[model samples]
Target: MRLVVFDVDGTLVDSQADILASMVDAFAAVGLDAPARQDILGIVGLSLPVAMEALVADADHARMVEAYKGSYAKLRLSKGASSSPLYPGARAALDRLQAQDDILLGVATGKSKRGLDGLIEAHGLNGMFVTRQVADFHPSKPHPSMLRAALEESGVETADAVMIGDTSFDARMAHAAGMPFLGVGWGYHAPSQLDGARAILNDFSELDDALNALWTD
Candidate 1:
């Protein structure tokens, strides 16, 4: 069987607006300034601490980090939570992949279990994914633990797997596991940022072609 592991945040859903808004609110709550939208979105694939580190240069970044978490959690739990929406054609692509008997679908993301669970369940996408590797269960991005765990859970070999995401981090993880990496253009990472990816697509329609070309060998 062919295993297709996807990144949830950018590849499936366009949560950049909500993510940036929440970060801005979090910074405001702590009396600190938030990074610009472009800057924040640039670090989308990294874990919270890593991303924050990239934004703050001061020594008191730890404290700011805590405050940011407080604001982010609160916002996610309340009003700003449901602002994220799936990218156009994401559902159709997933549905098409699900109908194939030889293909398996799963998720590998930096989002915490609670957050990912809420989003997946809310969109009724739980059944479409067989395995999930989230931040709560694994180390941050660039680590192979999450990908390894997801593959283990899905009973798939590294050779049979591919990672579909929008960030270089996702491509890096796939590289660590000797898996093919496909980058998306309509997501958080700019196309130029995904230089190491095996293939890059501007829209969902190109996905099947890329996958077929990769696996046909």
Candidate 2:
């Protein structure tokens, strides 16, 4: 069986604007300045704590985490999760993949299970994926554990699976898991940053071709 694992935030959806806005709101709630979008984007795919470590040099970790959660909750509770939306052709691409009897769909993302599930439910993608490995279950990106779990959960070997994402972290993680990486160009991370990827897909239209080629190999 061929299992295709995907990253959520940047690979299938564009949530940067909402995410950045929420980060700014979090910083304001804590009386701190928000980091630049470049900095935040650079740390895409990392776990929350890891992202914080990359962006904040002097802030107390625990305090900042609490503040961020508090502020994000305040905004998220009232905001109705308007940030994450499927990218153009994303649904079509996924449906095409699913139409193949040999292909199995799964998610390996840095998002929390609640967040991931919420997005999937909101977008009516409940049954699109057979398995999910969220941040709540494993260490952040650049670590092989998450991918490993996804492979295990989907009952597929790393060699038979492909990882699709939008950051260097995802490429490196796929490499670590001994799987092929397909980098998405329209994400927060630059395509150049994923130079080590098995292939870089410029958009959803290219995604089907990339997957077809990868599976054909």
Query: What are the lDDT scores of the predictions, listed in order?
Result: 0.81, 0.82
lDDT of 2 at 182: 92
Cα lDDT tens digits, model 2, 108-173, are 888777778777877778789988888877888989998888787888887789999999899999
Write down the TM-score for model 2: 0.92
| Quality of model 2 by C-alpha lDDT | 0.82
Best by the TM-score measure: 2
TM-score, each model?
Answer: 0.91, 0.92
Model 2 residue 141 lDDT score: 91
lDDT per residue as tens, model 1, 1-217: 8889999888998887667876786566557888788888877877777777778765355665566556556665664436567788888999999999999999998887777887886677878988888877777887888889878888888888899999888888888877888999988778888867878888888889999988887
Q: Could you tell me which residue pairs clash in candidate 1? A: none
Candidate 1 structure lDDT: 0.81
